[model samples]
Target chain A: SQTIHQWPATLVQPVGSPLSLECTVEGTSNPNLYWYRQAAGRGLQLLFYSVGIGQISSEVPQNLSASRPQDRQFILSSKKLLLSDSGFYLCAYERQGAPHEQFFGPGTRLTVL
Target chain B: QQQVKQSPQSLIVQKGGIPIINCAYENTAFDYFPWYQQFPGKGPALLIAIRPDVSEKKEGRFTISFNKSAKQFSLHIMDSQPGDSATYFCAASQITNFGNEKLTFGTGTRLTIIP
Candidate 1:
């Protein structure tokens, strides 16, 4: 079975600090990856998605950016974090041909103080 | 604009009671509808889904009922248990030639099943 993994299960960062969260998938190839943010009492917001290595699409404009350097490795980074950046960050994967069902990782809880 | 709208921001039901969550969409192009379950501090998981061609789909204790003409769908949990307490979200997507890559999700409903 395929599984998604994310690092830094929980993070607390000072304002203006750089941020880097990572996500990697195992047991699948050429899968689509996505990044989302969930604010308190708000719905999940799409931040970025990648089709393949070096191919990324931004769903919403933000200081955060995503990169896919390897087939199964995806990274979300920011040079400087803002208070608004605090939220629950999630990473999801959809099979290459089966896009309707998406599998999500454990997720990272980020608090920008 | 929000493409998918879900009602009853929160719901409370007794164990063994049936809890239904409803959702409606405005886009006719949408052909796929899915329901997801999320636990606190955890990512949402796919519970069940349905296509426009089918009026209903079921898996285990969960069921999805679709109304294409009404552009609405609902989730019905049978014999609900305390363990079923969590947040549920309804989403819709239009399958293009490439596939349904993007999903428009509803705000989500928080459910509590008390024993």
Candidate 2:
């Protein structure tokens, strides 16, 4: 069985501070990874996705960026966070085949003050 | 273009009732439709999915009905319970030649069940 892990489970960052969130998957290799953010009372928004290491596609332009440094390790980073950057961030992984089902990580709740 | 549209931004139902959420897509190329359930502060989980070739698929209390001609799909929850209260999202995707798939999600509907 494959599982995704993300940390820190909750974060509190001051405005204009640097931010980093990490996601790692176990029991799977070369899986598709995605980054999503959900604002309060809003739907999940796709931020970025990666097919392989060093390859990333960003969906919406925002203050955040994503990187796939390893086959199963993905990281979301920001040089300086904005108030709007505060939200619940999620990491997901899908198998490398047709009709793939996405498996989600525990997620991280970031609060910017 | 936003390919998927979902209805009933919020729904409130009593226990033992049924809750239905609808989604429509503009892309004909989408061959896979999936429904996801998300609780407060938790990541969304795949609830059920249906392919365009199939008209309907059911898993436990969750069901997905797909309409190929109309490019529409819906999720129905039977015997809704308080534990079933959550946000539900519909997604569409097409499989690439290389076998990679990317999903485009709907705005999502928040469902609440009263005791």
The model with the greatest TM-score is 1
Q: For model 1, report DockQ.
A: 0.66
Tell me each candidate's TM-score: 0.95, 0.93
User: For model 2, which pairs clash?
Assistant: none
Model 1, range B1-115, lDDT digits (tens) per residue?
7889997899999999999999999998887898989999899999999989999999999999999989999999999999999999999976544353777789899999999
Q: Return the TM-score for candidate 2, rounded to 2 decimals.
A: 0.93
**lDDT string, candidate 2, A1-39, tens digits:** 898999999999999999999999999889999898987
Task: Give the 10-residue window scoring lowest on summed lDDT in candidate 1 chain A.
Answer: A38-47
Per-model CA lDDT versus the true structure: 0.90, 0.88
Off by over 4 Å in 1: B95-100
